[model samples]
Target: MPRRWLMAALLALVPAGAGATPVNAYPDIARAYWVEIDGRPAWAGNADQAMPVASLAKLMAALVLDEEADLAGTVTVSRAASAATGTRLGVRAGETYLASDLFSAMLVRSANDVCRALADWHGGGDDDTFVARMNARAAELGMVSTRFANACGHDAPGQGSSARDLALLARAVMARPRIMEDARRESFAFASLDGRRFSVRSTNALLGQFPGAIGLKTGFTPGAGRCLVALAERDGHEVLAILLHAPDRWWDTVGLLELAFDQARRNAPPE
Candidate 1:
């Protein structure tokens, strides 16, 4: 099916007044944002505007890896991966590590090195191949407004994602129990085949501080600014909020989640 037709079909299913963009609800919230309560859009702003999303792109890479790669398999780091910029696990070239370990660090710490390594491994020594797979998967997921330039979320021309597109991506990630399990963790400990110990903590600050906060992802870049995909559950209600280029993501996410849950309660069918 055509991507636009797929998106239109998806939008048509939203309940009346369910997915309206209310810019006034939260001023200066972000460049683009979207919030959903149990898969139902509650509020949004610039939801379809394509913009830099930083490491949030990793979510899509992680999704592609989960579907195509074996977690139990091992991967050897490449020079390109070892030299990756931004946040990284500091993995040296030629080091061998479990794909699962690299996956954990990539998601939790936003480690660029390990992310690149995994991408190289999955691409059979070519990151571009992996990126092509990411783009193909994005289209399949109805993320028409997204594009991937690299395995690690790096700033590059022609690489961007929209708030709504990321919401769709996040939903796919949430469906994977293993990925969610790793994402929610406060920290992860692992070692390479040569016995190099490494410890990494979750970049998602909400894990311990926010009520019912669980596994999600965070990102930042000079171009992308601070981005976040926050998921929280309370009383069987799940709230997922995506913020791109948010200046105050921590506070904004908390407020958005609270509002989403409240809205969910208010809109509940009368008992």
Candidate 2:
């Protein structure tokens, strides 16, 4: 049992089995994993390793924009924004767009270009300044193992965060209804100022397919493999599951949720 969880430590006093599933039983191939049961730490695996988090770093962008930047303001796409590659919105430089739309582009579409656009706009100058603020926010949130090198979570030399740190981020994000609303969508259509149209589908596979799954996010890279921060609400209870560098995140998340919820129910004292 992970000693960091006081609940787990107390539960250890019971007979060995305690109707709990061992953390090792789940097929967690990710570099790290963490599960929160009713907003409490419950289980973890390699939860402290700072590994390439792919687009998961975009969570910081979402935070920065929500807390500091004006989403209603228009953003002028910069040369750097237009040049961003991989899972991008393909926005053009010199095009003007609403900051909120660009935000949707980043969260709903995981569009790299929009992320860069927001970073540039919110940084008040450059991405480094934005990333510096990201680091500061992480520290403010007490995410000691996390760091950011860029707004979009491409594999940068110093860009990395741990599953434990991400769990903190997930909680902070979920508390913001606006951010949750954006992450909860399945797809959205966005049009630039010049009437150019674009459609995007969410990379998060659980929203509709999984019962009770709500707003959260997903990530991928050759280095990060598959990363996901998923939240679900059932019977007025919420569960969060985090996976980093896992190939089968869909199944892994499902299995972890089922196992964790079952344990929670088993421990509940007769309703």
Candidate 3:
């Protein structure tokens, strides 16, 4: 199936009235919300409360890789990287790719293999080094509530951040033109040293579903329920919407971003 058509069909299945509920409406489900419109923090609920970030940590991991190594440089894969699981781009050991290609896979596909490969290549051949860089970057970014124990945000305890901190990180990542482009990519293909080709699709449903929605990240674990940092732009204004540990997680996010866009449009000054 064509990937865009598949996503469009999935979106058609979701009712247009999904966002009609009130902003705070949910059936006995606890949620954390933070919204920033046109460069200001305009709305928040439990924004400072800490929560597990899951794979959203990949942004930092990719940033660290960009800093420590040349994105245009080639990276040789190792066994450790090939072994990573969950939402992968199916990279094999002994294959080589430009660091920028792998970084694209890391951000757009949220591929564990690409992330592991970046960790191995740039972090002195160990994920611990990659994690340390994430921690240091978090501190440098003033993300005091964040502590990354791994490059990919798997369900390890103590690996998490608050809505506020993640928002800050989102803003930072958004500022990077390259990373932002990668994040917004719906699909891309990467070629290996052996001429084998692999492609991946974005995991953030909102990318293709919601109009004007762009890139960010998504994560899930039995412990984390479902978490997402979703972004959308309309009429020259960008809004960042976040939800942590919410039921009907996908719909919750879709609803939130839609509401945010609507609110922004309503509040937008005369052109």
- lDDT (0 to 1) per candidate: 0.86, 0.82, 0.75
- Give lDDT tens digits, candidate 1, residues 107-194: 9899999999999999999999999999999999999998888878899998999999999999999889878988899999999999
Candidate 3: worst 10 consecutive residues by lDDT?
14-23
Clashing pairs in 3: none
Candidate with maximal TM-score: 1
User: What would the TM-scores of all predictions be?
Assistant: 0.91, 0.90, 0.85
Candidate 2 clashing pairs, residues 3+ apart or interchain: none
In model 2, what is the error at residue 188, expressed in angstroms? 1.1
Candidate 2 lDDT over residue span 158-218, tens digit each: 8899988999899888878889889999998878888888889999989899888986989
**Clashes (candidate 2):** 0
**Per TM-score, what order, best first?**
1, 2, 3
In Å, residue 109's CA in model 1 sits off its true spot by: 0.7
